[model samples]
Target chain A: MFKSSRFPIYYKGHPRMFVKDKPIFWWALKWVHARFIIRELTSVPVAFYAIILILQIRALSLGPEAYANFTNWLKTPLSLSLHVISFLFVIYHSVTWFNLAPKAIVIRIGKNRIPGLVITGLNYVAWAIFSVAIAWLFLNLDNLM
Target chain B: MKKSSEPFWWALFGAGGVISALFIPVILFIQGLAIPLGWIESPNYQHLYQLFGSPVTRLFLLALISLSLLHWAHRFRFTLYDGLQVKHLNVLIAIFCYGGAILGSLAAGYYLWLI
Candidate 1:
């Protein structure tokens, strides 16, 4: 008896079963699901940080005074808080990405596949080295100049 | 069968994920927290300007910004589709996400060139 335009053919005394859409809030109902949701949401903070960097570049293009203003803004509580939240989210993203990398990247040497732990280990090591290199560059920028 | 553009976006997402994971945290810690909080000396304007003036640095920034945005676009598109269950608006979501990333990259390029 239930007939819709999309499903016009209906048997006598038979109605199409109606299934309700899953609510978005369902993701938060379980920790595992929430973690997955959080991982996807990390993109928002990553993109936000990129936009902030773009604005910094724009400030640099303007002149020294403008750049100074921009840096000054960076010192404010609001900027610091935003950056803190973004930093945490980006770190979470990094950890999850590294953990997932082994699954995504399978290496074979003469038909012997590398262990996932080794892949994940290498990712962490590389992350540490890169982080140190960048920190060294920033801390020693004056000396380098 | 028609070619699907999914792979292209997925590739960008993967590259951006690696790049951001490697670089963004330290950069944010230094520029966003350390220098701002006086834990480290903020590089003088002249030094920072000269740093940006280098072609290598400019190229790196361009790559980082562009890839990060592309990564965001790709992931966010899926987030909208699966997370929000707005799969019906697939075409529009794809266009908006990718288009925004492209525009952001162009803007970053323009500003980097200006600098």
Candidate 2:
């Protein structure tokens, strides 16, 4: 729903063109832009989590003690809070991304155009399947390992 | 200018965005909420190391890291343009953003592959 502002002519049909320049914080004023700004902000945590994953890999490479310490460090209140916040942000990002997919992709079987909700629903289904698979892996880690 | 390669980058951004959106959150839930908060035991380090060492895991991690970085780059570029109203530095901004993603991705690959 993020949209550009519909700027009005400040001076009515002036011979010298007059433009109404919006403030930099204009995005905060509109609901759509506000959502858009939050979406853009989600990239920070996405990038952070990516780096965290890399660090996990690196800690693993360093061997058991390092990995244990890293894991322990992550359990701290500050880290947990950040994780929860980032998790919320990432989930929001995913839901919005799925919802927006219909805009980017269009499928037509003969004459009937597939509904956007159907497309979004299919994505959610796939996501649910994957989440379960990962959960299964996590739960069975003891046996698998 | 010839037709801007905006669509091409957008496709990459889209792919990255979708992949990260679907995968990252669940992992975050487990690591952030489950394991750390005592909802579940911590994962075995050796097993995790073995997983990380595997070719498939490496490939998945690489894709996750690189593509997500590219996604960030593309989004950040537009955020700067439309949100900040800084339209004059088009070529410079494009290069900086895309270049950073490429460089970060390469670094991720190198570290993941070498160590």
Candidate 3:
């Protein structure tokens, strides 16, 4: 499609329809490609949640009143629903990305390579560790009120 | 047809993708889910403020927000090109996407500093 157009007058005798390149939205053609596109789209919500975190920081700077207001905003049904959707999309992003870990990193043990499931499972294992550590820290914060 | 500097942005994209996948989800679960749903009590504002006061926290926050922005920039650039079929304004799109990310990162840093 980027090339300069080349054309012939249907070979001068028998007119034939010319095939064009797939439209830009070609991702719709397959489930794999569509899911890939959806993965790409997750960046929007990821950045969005980051913005909210930054806002939380700003509110933190302002003292409890501002933070309380931010919490109040978040407690609204609309904000809660948005967070739920964002959480789901974030999970989708994580699952797809983690699933691709095996492809991105080939683990070789001398002569034999690690099985794909083991490689992929390692990602989940690491995830579980980090998450549990964070959960423990978050849950056991003695100073939390 | 020519060699492009896409790999640089892509490196940032990949780093950001991994960071978000590994770390952001749990934070989302905590702030976006647990706190709101009362599965966990909201930590006192002072406690969180103290958490953010550390230089380490500031730096970690910097990495998280900056990489995520750059990730968005790179992805949004391709999204425009492929999804919307914007063929002619390539350079402008790159400038807008990456530049916007840079600006947003700086803003995040500034706010983080204030925090």
Top DockQ model: 1
Candidate 1 docking classification: medium
lDDT of 2 by residue, A1-145 (tens): 1223556444445655545567889998989989999998787788778878877777777778988888988989888889989998999999898999899889999999999999999999989998988888887776787
- When summed lDDT is taken over every stretch of 10 residues in candidate 2 chain A, the lowest stretch is A1-10
- Global CA lDDT of candidate 2, please? 0.83
Q: For model 3, how does the per-residue alpha-carbon lDDT over A58-137 read when each residue is reduced to its tens digit?
A: 88888899989999988889888888888888889889889998888887899999998997888889888888877766
Structural similarity to truth (TM-score) of each candidate: 0.92, 0.87, 0.86
lDDT of 2 by residue, B51-87 (tens): 6778987899899988888888899889888788777
Any residue pairs clashing in model 3, and if so which?
none
Model 1 chain A: worst 10 consecutive residues (lDDT sum): A1-10
RMSD of each: 3.9, 4.2, 4.2
Error of 2 at A59 (Å): 1.5
**Whole-model lDDT values for every prediction:** 0.90, 0.83, 0.82
**Candidate structures ordered by DockQ, highest first:** 1, 3, 2
